[model samples]
Target chain A: MPELRQEPITKNWVIIATERSKRPSDFSVKKEKRKGGTCPFCKGNEGKTPPEIMAYREKGTKPDTPGWWVRVVPNLFPALAKTGAGETHEQNFYLTKPGAGAHEVLIESPEHDASLETHSQQHVREIFHAWRDRYQALINEEPIQYIQIFKNEGSIAGASLEHPHSQLIATPLIPPVVDEELKGAQEHYQEHGNCIYCEMIKHELGVGRRIVAKNDHFLAFCPFASRFPFETWIIPQQHQAGFDSINDQQLHSLSIIVQEVTQKIRGSLNQPPYNMVLHSAPKGHSHAADYHWHLEILPRLTIVAGFEWGTGIIINPTPPESAAEYLREVNTNLVEEKERLSWQQVH
Target chain B: MPELRQEPITKNWVIIATERSKRPSDFSVKKEKRKGGTCPFCKGNEGKTPPEIMAYREKGTKPDTPGWWVRVVPNLFPALAKTGAGETHEQNFYLTKPGAGAHEVLIESPEHDASLETHSQQHVREIFHAWRDRYQALINEEPIQYIQIFKNEGSIAGASLEHPHSQLIATPLIPPVVDEELKGAQEHYQEHGNCIYCEMIKHELGVGRRIVAKNDHFLAFCPFASRFPFETWIIPQQHQAGFDSINDQQLHSLSIIVQEVTQKIRGSLNQPPYNMVLHSAPKGHSHAADYHWHLEILPRLTIVAGFEWGTGIIINPTPPESAAEYLREVNTNLVEEKERLSWQQVH
Candidate 1:
């Protein structure tokens, strides 16, 4: 019979369907659908999307016009919106809250093919600054309790629009994932009197096996328990709890590492779809000392199967050390040229 | 830097790679790589896999032969094995454990085209019996702490072989997901004097909006807080915490509901790739009254994006009520015939 299985730590329940099962062949992987049409995110098409909430444009450009390297607009079809600060309602054993939140899309460039790997480092730094700036602005909104800044790079990573962009979702409630991490961090702080993320960085450096790349202010490495193949993380070497806490020099360092790791992945895996998310301390909440903010870049190279979904335990085939070693050896200059050549051919 | 972020609920740590960022167009959906030429799971190819651990065969049929309707064997390339129970080695901030456990494959049928939707109910029941029988046996092994039985239907769902089969992964530690659920159930029982799952089932039945299908001894419903679109759960009417606690009549009823629900899904989504997992109480463990085991069927129609991975909050575009209502109206018999005609054309 189908039964409810509760996850031990998170206390989340998943229903396991036991009765009818399909053969391996019965399930077919459909080709990813790529919508081809006039680019809505491109320059001169600002009218196709919601009007710009914030844009870093040329010295006298209009609000919704061209010449903007970084543009922030509300999601046309947002999962959560600012219009209704709906409260959560309860119905017996089930619990639900209004999805009163803000959703914005950050267009990285005016051109369709301007990827992070192909973009100039200076421009990428502007994108990072834009992310932190929006984060700071959104966190102060009364309805928003959590700000999620994430980028989906391909259809596999859940991007519907073929645009080089990042998304920010400002939710009213603390996201379950973040809440858990906060709790974990707090507990670790109480027990050890140290930031767990900071401790992790210290220990990993001592081990050195999982380190992929490093800059003066930032470090890139593969995690000890990587759930996916070639999963990489980038974090500021100096402990900081919020993305907005970053300074100009830190932003530059962050941008370089981001570009470096991205290029490494493209060169090594020959360009795979990936998802990147910046995780920081919850806004309007204290526990800044306990939590150390970081960015997580997950490459969509493998499928999360039944075992993973059922047990909440991943069975990764590749070891983290091997993945890190392969990425570290990738030639950035060669990869950049190759990416540009590919973009030239496509665009 | 790359660091392990432990999910609070399940305590399952994920490696978050943050440095790399790719464009939406950089990711390419890989074509499902089906290794052609050999049919390893066929009746005559029984020698291809490890020797049978158990099998349901006709009278006088010998082991390692073609007469078995359902067969069980050890995984050739197991993620965790019985040979070495590797103890988790701890680094300063990282935790590592030996993946010492059992991995088994249950071939549902001899034919590649055999699916729960296509196979007779009697045969599927036999497969269920095999699962329980094996579960009972594996739990007694010294290294086995928990058992997980899951089936990946399509390539997207993580099945490499095109055979009709299910996998059994017996782990040395209680998986974080299962552990979290057990704790939740225990706490719920202590406070309310009831099983959380039973309470949930009662509540869901009272509000029939999310219900997909139900039989005499079991109920099938899409949860109010479904993480995925058309994410359905099946539960027994009575509170049975352990799967092995099921008697003959319960098994028969369970098989019927399973078949009905699977048919409904195929009809509703035109046979989208999916993952079905059987979640039962850990064997040789106590706390039976507090926990109730169920099955979860998650359809791969939507992508779990960056927000999902980052915040553990799902943004399902389709609500449970609409999904259940659509599923309830599908003509399963017509869909079955249509499926048969398509199979005939393909094979």
Candidate 2:
């Protein structure tokens, strides 16, 4: 049955419904396929795109060569530009500023079909490092105030290209939605003298029904108020206000947990199209003692209808407890075992 | 040129881009030709739907008959139900309650081809009255705490049916997004000792940049920080917390303004798909001193990609000033003028 779960901090309600549960095979994965033509992001087509801003390649390999493991490039049709003296002007009751911001793409792997869940832990770790480096570089820009890092896996989730990659955009202002979260966390801290996310972690750990997977350093669980069906969040066990603060050991552990959670979702829901976003404090903001950085995963399962648009309340068809139970039942081999089996099968 | 605008209260930014401006002739309105046999909303198919909850008919006409000017009925596949005893249960860390609420549909016209923009002012008034009656009835129910009234005009805007109509869904909880607006407005009021919306109206009136249309009683403007292109909002000049409190004369004036705005958009933008929502105070909330009731109109002119979903900031392509300028240029004809033209053309 569908169950309503409330967010402890924002008090938003999400419905999880087990009765309307769908298995992995039931999910339709054939996304709208873009016709391949003069596609710039494809391998051996580097000259078609803007010159690479950064890339990871073998020592002695040239910039846009075929040997690169990962690459970063500016978006050709960027919503915000990289170069402009940030300025704001007012006209009558309205105010406007130049669309000054950075939009960059992080290609995860050389292979066109490789996904994060399918990558080795070391490969995933390298991707994490690239993300951190980009975040740091963007934050260092004088005009940038906020940086957003996100991935749209399939067309339904808004990925225009079929390549497995993520994007990062740095904006000149702190978005209101993030600001509201900061304010809520600040107010909660003032009242309780503790981080609101920490309280939620404690309560969730004690209850254990919404948990999907966990390790010593990271925990993955279905949020109390999931905005979408089978939505999940991964948070550090310790209070950390910034994504850059994640240590190598924690990154390794998080990679394992993330892999496990995604594998479970893939095995259970047939690799449904989804979007994942990493949320951190804005650049130059004082370290928020009451805020914790986390990753939010939303599966594009149902279309948002009139009611949700009008009221900003989501009606989730699947409840979290049932989702957790279903996820827990999926059989996943350890990384080593899977690697060994794959190697043996290949040989 | 595209310009960014910000909402003073929420501080969200929207981009207004007129470079990609389209005329009405450019819009493709090939109606979704769904076969009539499978459509449950077709006339003479009354038995397929729930019994008519209410209808406006001639003195001796029967329910669900041809003589009715408008109709109200229960949604066949309702997101929320009418008959359920409220129950809240705890499952580990999550809490859930029955989806007990009201979901009703207001059929706008019987001809099926007629839209709200084509309706007479009196016809629109009757629809508003129906909404008022339904609002009054649903709020008095045991579990409903908030009521939302909205219209979705096209499939891209989340309308499943091609028919012209609106929906009202009363919920037991206040949505988080709505709460954020309320909190922001309340905070502003406490700090400035004034209603934030009234202050905004005064500022907009003074500045005159974003104003689309205004009268002695109502003011329509493109919000500084619109979330979408050509987005517009209508607010009462007086401080009213609830839409149900609208008097008949006020309703008439509102109908005139709404009609004029809709006509302008239809003429200016080639009948762009849009969503219009009426935001009012929650049903039983006593502290509405800081709340302001308004109608938000969002045109479905752009796709919200990953950046918007992750950061909650919208990039509008058209500036509000340019949008208002375009709207102001349109020749607005009141209902009487339209009637006179039709009669003259017929003769």
Candidate 3:
């Protein structure tokens, strides 16, 4: 069984696979260090994967079939599983517990190469729906406290498959990152009676230097202290603490904003690899003024070496103002023109 | 001027370059994307770099000469510098400060390709001395509060130059990561009257499941919460708060143990890219049993993707016990055989 071990000092948890441990030489035999030619996420290869957990399919299509558009399947190699009973195992200074959770991959489109930027807004909206649906479903589980929704866009961004997909991993613990954010948000609420993210959105709009895109209900901007080059955040204009609190209007607005921001990035950087993540309050936490959920898109343009690892601080070469200026000026229409052919094929 | 921008919520500082703002295309024009030729870090190319900040030279040899066995030079493009006055700039929701610090490179050897594993013990010892020497010197500077010493071994590990070198970036502020570590250590000390790391060392020694290399004064092990595959921590056996407090006896032991551990890694994995970092408490706050500084060596065997970025948790495939077992059994003779020829040429 893979056990989650917590580092005493930093309180960081690491998953250690004891049962099926890999040797040093195992890293060298990486199946695909380069391009993955044929993707199992494609339309006809539904049987190649485990049966779908939840998928959007045509009326006549079976569970594991070719007609699904947005499909969720169990990861071939799951980092965490739902099999383990809820238990905490501990030694003197080392803490261990079974990694009991869900690791599911959400195939965004039947087309292997289709991305949110390349797909239609309606298609992108479905992905958001699926994410919310998974989050709501996972939260109902007894042991699950948090569900992390993230996407690795390219090979360098840690996507082994070239296919466009997102991942949802439900964990029994509220991860330290989210915990820290919650603590900070709670602190802010205590001091000022306002969500910090709400203040940030208002501040960014007032400054206008770091605003990348804004819609009726959503706003996207290069973060003031972005850890990566061209790192951007998309947040709801309203103060909703959890992602589950998002309504139909906000979801529609988010779909448009997500597409626009990603389109700007792709058009500007020629589609550099990136990681996108959704941050939300933990389960049982209601929509309060204390916290607000948002999404972070980190462009994997630089190598995070020793400095970043040792110190939590980051050395961002591009200033957020400049990044916002550049991204704001990019013709998202270029992506539209480029996606026209792929869009036709998907239809 | 480059500014240190702090994220208001997390209190994470980022170095934002304001002067030489890299455009979208500037990052694409990265030098030495492939194999480097006529290397500037080579012995004869002394004039190519900024004048030596510090160098260990043979007797009667002048500065920037070929006689130096070890050298330290200022990074041509420093991320942070000593130019800014200590002042804070605050916008509504964002905080900024002057990026006043020191950034320099410690050339490990005169030879371009010589690394710690392949270099003789004597040569590697000098590199450690140079690290301490620079740290001591930089800490005495007025605005410098902490110095982060690190080495990136390969291009994938963020080494633009193939030349073996380590970096020291002194900062004016105590970084958030170190702060969190200090907070955790203090909490541990307050509750248990012990340093958490000291407790960890004792615990690991008692269990012996994750021990990699050990000597009288120092022990290296895969951390209980191993964030990276084959991630190892080299901690002092004796409970000392800081890395700078080490004497001659400990340095000698550290040199051997470092060489042994790297040799084991190289012998078993065929010389993979890695990043080594020295973590120490901030100045004016050390040697008081409150913090225990150690060196972290992270092998760049896996890519950090969305899950890690989003959750601040790592999913390591290899168990620490298995990693330690494999590394412990490796023959150090492999590295010794590879170094014999290089050692002769240098002598």
Candidate 4:
């Protein structure tokens, strides 16, 4: 069984995944290359995977059938299990809990080569709708306090399969990153009676230098203290504390901005690997006034070394102003045309 | 000039290194391979680097010459500089400061291929002495609040050069990670009236399940909540808050334990890339009763992906108990023989 252990000093929780435990010799084997094979996520291989929990399919089609465009299923090798009790205990002064939660994969498209940057706006909206559904479902669970939705786009970004997909992990406790954000937000509210994220958006708008893309409902820009080069964030224009609360129109606008920023990154950097994560208010903080939801996309261009790990301070080589300028200048229309041509060939 | 920018919520400071800024096109270029070239850190090529800040050289040898066994020099592409005033300013509600501090490289040896695990115990002790000397010198700087000493052992671990070396970066403020530790330690001390790390040592000693190596003055173990596979910590048995206060005899024992741990890691894991970091109390708090200094060695065996970035929670695939058992079981004598043979061949 996997266990969640908390460091005594820092209170940072780590999941000791004994279920997928590795010996020293296991690390010596090089990472497996993604070769041409029968992808379990492909349309015809629905039977190869576990039964689908939810999916968007044709009206009369069955659940695990070829008509589904988007699908959600349990992770094959989950980091946390659904059967555990999720009980906490102390042994020898160390706090530990069973790794009990849900790990699911959201297959974005039936097509194996489909990616967020290359997908159509409507298709991307469907992906968001699927994510919203899962978030809503998991947030109501008795033991779940936080639900994390993240996507790793390439092998280097920790994607195990070639098929484009996103992941959702429902955790039993509030994660440290979210807890820190909440504390910061609450402190700001107590001091200034305003959301710090709102202030950040207002400041970025006033400066007009770090803006990458903006629409009526959403804005994307490089954060001033970006931890990675070309790191970008997309925040809702309206005050919203939960990602699941996004309306259809807002989701439409978000899809456009997200796709545009990702396309610019892909085109400008020669298709670098990246990770996208959604940050939202935890379950009971959906109506909090001090919180605002956002999405962060981090490009994996540099290796994080000892300094970063030691100090928790990042040394970003590219300034946010430069990154924003480069991203804003990218001819996304040209990129769209090039992607369309290659996508047609692949089809 | 490079600048330090703090995130509004997390208060994590990031170095916007505009002086060494990169264009979007620059990231498209592959990282430079460590090829055969004029090795700057080698015995005969000391002129390639900046002037020596300090060195443990023979009496007859001049500065930046071949006789130095260990040398310290300014980093060629430093993340922080020594010239600017490290003054804080508020710009558009964001905290900003000049990236003014010091970044230096500590070449462990004149031999091009020597490493911590393979070097003699005496050489390793000299490396620690160099680190302590640099720490003592930098801690007295008026603007400096913290000093970070770390090493990247392989190219994948962010070593740009093949030669074995460590780094020291003095900062104008305490980093977020150290601040978190200090806060946690103070809280624990207030409640328990004891040092948390010392308690951890006592517990680990009592259990004897996660210990990797131990000496008279030092103990090495895989932490209960290790963030990575084979992540090990070498802590002093006695309660010490500052690394710079190490006595000569303690340094000798530390070197022995450190080398033993590194050798076990390299031997058991096939010499995977790793990072070593020294974690000590910030200046002015070096004598705090709560804080204890330790060294963390993180093996870069897995990719930290979207889940970790989103939650600040690590999912370690190896349990600390298993890792400790494997590390403790390694045949260090066999590893020593293999390294000696390789050294002979390289020479």
DockQ category of candidate 3: incorrect
Model 4 clashing residue pairs (backbone): none
> What is candidate 3's lDDT per residue for B290-332, written digit by digit as tens?
7888999998766789988888776666656667777776778
Better of 1 and 2 by DockQ: 2
- Give the chain B TM-score for each candidate: 0.84, 0.88, 0.86, 0.86
At residue A88, give the lDDT of candidate 4: 60
For candidate 2, the iRMS in Å is: 3.4
Q: Write the per-residue lDDT of candidate 1 for residues B1-347, one digit (tens) a residue.
A: 21123222232322222222222233333344444347677798888988999999999998989999999998877766666654555555555555667788999998877788877878878888898899888787876778899998877778878688999988777776787788877877798898888888877777777788776688888876665667788889898877877778888777777777888785556566789987888866534888887888887766788988888766665667667776666566723332221212211
User: What TM-score would you give candidate 1 relative to the actual structure?
Assistant: 0.87
**Best candidate per DockQ, number?**
2
What C-alpha RMSD separates each model from the true structure? 9.0, 5.6, 11.2, 11.1
Number of colliding residue pairs in each model: 39, 18, 0, 0
DockQ for candidate 2 = 0.38
Please give the distance, in angstroms, between residue A139's alpha carbon in candidate 1 and its true position after superposition.
0.7
Task: Looking at model 2 chain A, report the run of 10 residues with the lowest lDDT sum.
Answer: A338-347
lDDT of 4 at A186: 88
Off by over 4 Å in 3: A1-37, A334-347, B1-36, B334-347
